[model samples]
Target: MKWLLLSTLAVLLALAIAEGEVWEEDDHEVLIRSERGAKNQECRYAKGAWTECDSKTNQRSRMLTLKKGNATNCEPTKTMQKKCKKACRYEKGAWAECNPQGQMTRTDKIKAGSDSSCEQKREITKKCKTKMAKPTKGKKAARRNRN
Candidate 1:
């Protein structure tokens, strides 16, 4: 009886240690905060790229691939995805799309020939270019070192 009790306690201790109080994985932590839905539906956490898994007819599901931005490398389960769509809303403009690849430019850059509105196009192009410019050398170096 004494040996059995001791053995049981030892096993329990080992299990607790194995489970670990703090375990860190280099895996990306993806957080999808849906402004308008259920908690689980509004946010998803996965271990790889986002995969759209939908069975509902006429309903379009998005397979978002997030990198080091707001979203990470995790796919939300089908249920979670459904919840997220209902929750998320376009904060600005008609709609804003964010994916793992990056932001998509809807309007074409100011066309060169056939002159329609060069001034407006040029202004938009300049602003867009500046906004999308890469980080400075120092900031880039820091990012590289983080990995």
Candidate 2:
């Protein structure tokens, strides 16, 4: 049963990746907050052709979005055929795996030409850690051999 579950997940993940490109992969250890769209789509040249796709907005979301972008302007040629992936969106878009440091790492698989960031995570983590951590006395440690 465990193996079956793992294999199913693996297949779904592969399909998701092939559907589009991952813009950012960040696995961190802190809380994160950001305002972004539910889904991101892009166009790419693959296998001597072009493909237009958008990642799944979240888990439990299926159906790879295609030709939803500026594909009409792109107008790939016959030789530059687009891949009718004949696939579904498994689990795409922003997903995360946090570490033990109370950090929530984020991974984003968005279309190309998209710019997004997690601004609040940085500010919040810094403030929280500063408030909770104890001050250290004595000389600060260095990562080298002092003369």
The candidate scoring highest on TM-score is 2
- The CA lDDT at 4 in model 2 is 80
The ten-residue window of minimal lDDT in model 1 covers 120-129
Best by lDDT: 1
Runs in model 1 deviating more than 4 A are 22-147
User: In model 1, what is the error at residue 78, expressed in angstroms?
Assistant: 28
Task: Predict model 2's lDDT versus the native.
Answer: 0.34
Candidate 1 TM-score, true structure as reference: 0.15
Per-model TM values vs. the true structure: 0.15, 0.17
In model 2, what is the error at residue 18, expressed in angstroms? 0.7
Model-by-model lDDT, in order?
Answer: 0.38, 0.34
Off by over 4 Å in 2: 21-147
Q: How many pairs of residues collide in each model?
A: 3, 5
TM-score of 2: 0.17
| Model 2 lDDT, residue 78, Cα | 19
